[model samples]
Target: MQKTCLAFAVVALLQPALNLWASDASLAVFEKRILPILQASKPSSCTECHLSGVELKDYIFPEQDKTFAALVKADMIDLKQPEQSKLLKFIERRPEKPSLITDKVRVEEAAAFREWIVAAVKDPQLLKAKSTASVGPQVSDELIRHARKDRVLNSFAENVWSEVGRCAACHSPDKNQAQVKKFGNRVSWIKPRDMQGTMQNLLDSGIIDVDAPEKSLLLAKPLMQVEHGGGQKMLLGDRTYKQFRAFIDDYVAVVKGTYKDAKALPKLSQEVSQVSEIWLKIEGIPKSLDKQFLRADVYAKTADGWSKERVATGDRAIFGGGGLWQQHLTLTAPRDSARAKELLSAQKLAGGEYLVRISIDRNNRLAQDPNSDFTKEDVIGEVPVRTNWPSGYGAMTVVKLPAQTR
Candidate 1:
């Protein structure tokens, strides 16, 4: 009984020393492996998931004890099972197709954190350490999520990728082989059907000026504010230009971390649209309306009367001398609606009778204010037409202006 009592006393006396030794070892691991991550000039593994606003170093500190304590206080470290630490889980999260270099960095970062966390949790001193210092990003969770790569990509797809068709003839790798031979591969800014690759190419080619978004070559070149080999592909206040600016401006804001809350983030449009090959022509346009912007909204004839929403829309400056206005149509639908899903797979206007509402910008409002949109007051007339909306410039559906206006 005395021998057993003495054995218990020895362990009780050595407990504090053992904890101190274990704590020192854990601190060594943090200083050697983890501190390098904090001090490195390059971004850590967090870049794999976050474009900005968050980094692995945000959870670390110069002082090991402070970092351990803060992480503990924030519930980032799981004492019962250190391997299941939230910080480790966060570090492990990766995109579907991560860059090889970043993936390597991610592996190293996860291993370093796992080693330190496993050892530190076993040290009673680290478990008992207390700290008031914050251990993660200073921004709100909403901002962090907004800065995620997936979210950024989705925004790119909606605002910029959807408009690439306007530039694809000269910019896409699949179609710009001749341009590449003359202008070098630099002109092939777009990857074939790869949104992420296209975005990266834009960034790498200095087309997207995050620092001065308005001055970006991507916007300036298309607007003809800068010399462009493709001539003027987009007007200053046209739908294509608006969509590009919306994406570039928002991308700059996101990277700069200017938004304080979710409300500050830019709102997405309720409607979705896609450029299509379907064309429309209106004859007998007045010479006075020449060079004036004309917009046409096509509504499918439904059992009730017409679709509550326009099925397709097209806009362009009228040709006064030709006494007609012609442009390709853009399929439209409310986002997330059944129509939107259908348009996603196929951009075809079904064969049927339709009502075409025409609006004329007499005051040049769109040019004066790019943000201005057509309203009921802008409607000049409505013409009824019946035809299968075929695809191609050669198969354009033709209609005449209302007799009153003609």
Candidate 2:
């Protein structure tokens, strides 16, 4: 009787068909957030490193759903405590049990991935949930279908042209609008003549980091996370970054020999969409931050004048040059977790008249704080904004310096 009951519980967790996808949302979350990291992990060769000699990839998870269930059951994932997971701990570089993989996940990418894991773990069934849809075309399905080397370049040509055109703009012989010549000789991603050779060179030349694709110079140069003479061209959290990450997946696949020039890779998609989310594109600030960068002291006006909570802050220049700057922020609230609901409620109460404040930090020491009257050093702007925003919707707001009043 005891053995039978134990077997039944095991069967429930491993209930193949029903447990696999859970829903489109879960599948989407897994495909976008988890798949890239997993593909980079070399699960087929997990036994090479572990003392137990356990292979956790195809051996254990023959299918997508099984992998999802296995992650949850093995205590490798947790919704409530995402950062403190066994899987992350194993891969995190530290003095103890350092990750053996030459390639490791970036800190920002890891944090973003946790959001996806929590979403999948919390709601196995994504019903009543508004799973997200990106602003650009959804390629989650298309990627798995045509992830081969040659075909990948075609699919990538479509997606890459849309996202990384900035790279092509400066690097290509045709579009070197900036006349940036030094990199032109090393390799040209613009021409189609020697794509395999060019890409292989790009991959091997240290432009693309296999372990942390997000940290690759291909991405970092455009993102402003690292210094670029061009200044910041791409905002970190925008649709552009997401699209580029998607391309990285295929690039990694091709590099790792999982997909070749002729055959198609599996049409796998992982989603990391949040429930309540909003995007902010604040423009019209001086780009020449002679001393300090732009910072928005986010606040909500409650019944008692203003809410004490600091909703969100801004950093980095999305578009910077000629002494002018712009910033984009994606604000999200994941249901009842933390301050998500509070932000959602504040957004719901918003009127055509400004409900939030966007203050600029002109100096390194000056206070752009929303707590007190920002009449002195802080130049603030208020825009009539809407909230509880759809997946990829961004509020296009302007900032006029030296705001007239509080």
Candidate 3:
């Protein structure tokens, strides 16, 4: 009993000294490892999941006591079980195929925080430390989620990937071998069904200018604001240009953390559209209107007159030489509607009688002001049509341009 009491007393007496040693050790590790992470110019492992708005450094501080206190106050630190610290778990979160360099950085970051946390928790001083300093992102959780890589990719799919068909003939690797030979592999920006790969390539190839999204090569080249071998594939304010700009602008804003609230986030288009192989041809376009841009909105003939919304739409410059205009139709529906859900898998228009409203941009107004749309004054004419809306240029539903109404 005496020896047991003596041993217990010795341990009790040495406990304070042991804790002091542990505190010194944890401080040393934090200074050498965690401090370097905070001081490094490059981004931390948080970027593996977040494109912006959060970083590992945000959870850390130069002073160990303040960092520990802030983390404790924020409920980010697991005092009883340091290995389960939220900070360490965050550092460990990584994508399935992380970049080799960033993966290495992630491993080092996780290990550093793990070691520091494990040691720090054993130090009573650290557990008792009090600080008013706050840690973590200053942005709201909505903004953080908006900036996540997955969210960004979903936006890319909606605003950019869906429109790649317009550029696929010259930029898709599977189809652009000849262009690849002439312009190099860089010309094959589209990765054939790989949305994430295509987005990464766009960023890597400098096609997306995050600093000035309007000046991005993807938009500039298509608009012919910069020299492009493909000529002008899109006008300044056309549907394709609008979609591209929407994604680019939002991406830049998210990366820069400029959106302060959910209300500030870009509003998603109320309508969802997908490019379809179904073709529409307008013949007998007056030769005088040659080269003028033309738009067609197809509305299903319902018992109530028209469907009140265009079921399919197409636009192209009039082939004045052929006295015609033809292009693939884009099926569209109000977002979250039953029809929108159906169109996701089946890009087709129901067979029925329909009204085709035609508008001609005779003044090149769309080229001058992208925001301007074909108004009632621009209506060339409306034609009643009947067809199954076939799916190829060889089998397009042809309509003669109505005599000018205005």
Candidate 4:
């Protein structure tokens, strides 16, 4: 009886922790790591203004959204570049307000905030809103092989040496600038645009279709023959053209679900799915693992709303197979599941697309290492789920997975 009571009490305690784990991964870490800093400071009610939520809410820039929040959590900001980062300016309050703290608590909080800002500035994902990897056309391997072979004929490199094909002479892989005297001082350029905004504009103007191959510039650009002002055509035969094409495709994918007009990316809310099977294997858990962590609950949405579905009990449900130290979690996306249903439910549109969001909280111990001091909740990396359903409804999930620390 005592063992049963103890087990029940433990399960009750873990329920909320797991729910928080499922909700927003960063929140758990954020509240744990930074809440003390904020509470300790106790900003003045004076200064002729009052801001809500410990840290002057009104002082924080309006542009810093959830993604930025992750950056903050991760502590990837540079304190010196106030103009470049709002967090630094907000915290230093150097030229703004040098006289807010009157106690040790406030002084310590201010110092911690400054240290976090410096670290946050170094995170690349926070520095730019988009990623920069280029995976070229969606063609088959055979097509890629053929394309490579065709490049051997009077290749752009050969032309450069002969003083004709100035592709390499001007746009050197080293310094991506033009070699003015050699290439007539002019090179065709496609300036990077806010990919999410550009795609939204095209969609709103009816210039593209979500599914139609003809609607996407990605599908059409390769075959375009018109001179691109500087005399380069979007031809499949040009190696230079292929490089630029690949860059644009990747930019589009990163912000695929982001809407142009929405000030920030929208949060995901629900996913529709039906239960198929369950698996559990955390039986004789090892001592090294954090046993305080419990099994995560899986859920599916329907006309009635999100319904709880059992997957596995305790840590068995956690996807944990990646060889050595690698770990992962298993979750289902309704669309990929065999038993998805489209039932009408109230929709909330934040950005352009519809999305399902997962909410969960987990624990993190802050005192383990001094280097961990630089970490903050807002800087952690996240994966976004964005979709457009045939029924005119959409869903998304802004995922916060465990950091793949190298």
| lDDT, each prediction | 0.88, 0.48, 0.87, 0.31
Candidate 3 clashing pairs, residues 3+ apart or interchain: none
3 against 4, candidate with superior lDDT: 3
Best by lDDT: 1
TM-score, candidate 2, is: 0.31
Number of backbone collisions per candidate:
0, 16, 0, 48
Query: How high a TM-score does candidate 4 get?
Result: 0.17
Each prediction's TM-score versus the true structure: 0.94, 0.31, 0.93, 0.17
List where candidate 1 sits over 4 angstroms from the true fold: 1-10
Q: After superposition, how far is residue 340 of candidate 2 from its true place, in Å?
A: 30
- State the lDDT at 291 in candidate 2: 29
List model 2 lDDT by residue over 288-369, tens digit each: 5432444454455567755554344444442445444334332333334455545423433233223445544444332232
State the weakest 10-residue window (summed lDDT) of model 2.
Answer: 130-139
lDDT of 2: 0.48
Give candidate 4 misplaced runs (Cα > 4 Å): 1-166, 170-224, 228-234, 237-243, 255-406
lDDT of 3 by residue, 34-146 (tens): 99999999988788789888988888888999999999999888988889988877888879888899999999998898899899998898888999999999789998999
What value of lDDT does candidate 1 attain over all alpha carbons? 0.88
Q: What TM-score quantifies how close candidate 1 is to the native fold?
A: 0.94
By lDDT, the better pick of 2 and 3 is 3
User: Which regions of candidate 2 deviate over 4 angstroms?
Assistant: 1-146, 149-159, 177-184, 192-206, 223-227, 253-406
Candidate numbers sorted by lDDT from highest down? 1, 3, 2, 4
